[model samples]
Target: MSKAFTKEEDGTEKIRLDDLPQSTHPNLVTPSGLADLKARLAAARLELENLRARPEEIDSTMAIAVAERDIRFLESRISKAILIDPKDHSSGVVEFGATIDVVNEEDEQLTFRIVGEDEANPAQGLIAPYSPLGVALLGGETGGTVEWQKPSGVVELEIIAIRFE
Candidate 1:
């Protein structure tokens, strides 16, 4: 028999499942980030409950295991969350939860909001404060320049505005 068919000491074959990667950086969050985390935790709990109630479903064991793992992860994240109100920070410089308006060398204007890693969605203009562009923009005042490396080349951005709201 192949090793794949062998059972472990527990008398059960190990199931290989991929878990979500946790960020090592500080678990900082804006008020919105905190809210999102709570919502996620609640959703995960509901999902696990649903999975447990449907034991007859095909692959329900795997689903329940995955859901349980997700719940644990979400719970950990929620417990570690440090809430930071954006309004408390200075608006003159770019920082976490600051909405920034920048113009590139090409004069193309773009906007981004610096947020917590858990809340970051680049496609939605939300970036993690530890991200390259976010780090470069931090502490930068309006009219200051920041640069970030891209596959094509390093791009420079000029800060036009920073708002805490």
Candidate 2:
């Protein structure tokens, strides 16, 4: 998975399944995935060929593709990047794997499914506990609000409740 994510502000609808504790996936390569990655590597190599032929004409698109390929290469090293144990419980206090219900500044209710960096999905409302908003909520008790700095200005969030899935 890619570390970069496009977060949507006006999005809604979420369900927190369970908190994953540890990763128990086998540390081995998937033969099919390896084969597919090899093909992509070959295709990228071909693109590089065309790029090399016109060194002065290569643009940012090709450059970005190369960079993305590099990232995928490194990511392929791990068999299971994000593993949810499906049994992690933070014991009431908001921890790394806790699911929280937050009300935004507009008084609209929202829920964010917090996960690890590998499993962070903004669309699914899964945020990394280490992120800015996540940091503010860590170790916080219910009924209190989490304050943080946003691009527009300072923002405050109230933790209505926490649901453990």
List where candidate 2 sits over 4 angstroms from the true fold: 1-86
**lDDT of candidate 1 at residue 6, scale 0 to 100:** 40
Q: Which stretches of model 1 miss by more than 4 angstroms?
A: 1-19
lDDT of 2 by residue, 8-105 (tens): 36452222222224334332222333444456566766665665566455364445445445545534533353344323554667765667888879
**What would the per-residue lDDT of candidate 1 be over residues 1-165, giving only the tens digit for each residue?**
111234559674434355567889989999999998889889988987897687678887677667767877888888888888889987698878899999999999999999999999999999999998888888999999989777789999999999998
List the lowest-lDDT window of 10 residues for candidate 2.
12-21
Q: List lDDT for all candidates, in order.
A: 0.84, 0.59
Candidate 2, residue 135: CA error in Å? 1.1
lDDT of 2 at 125: 79
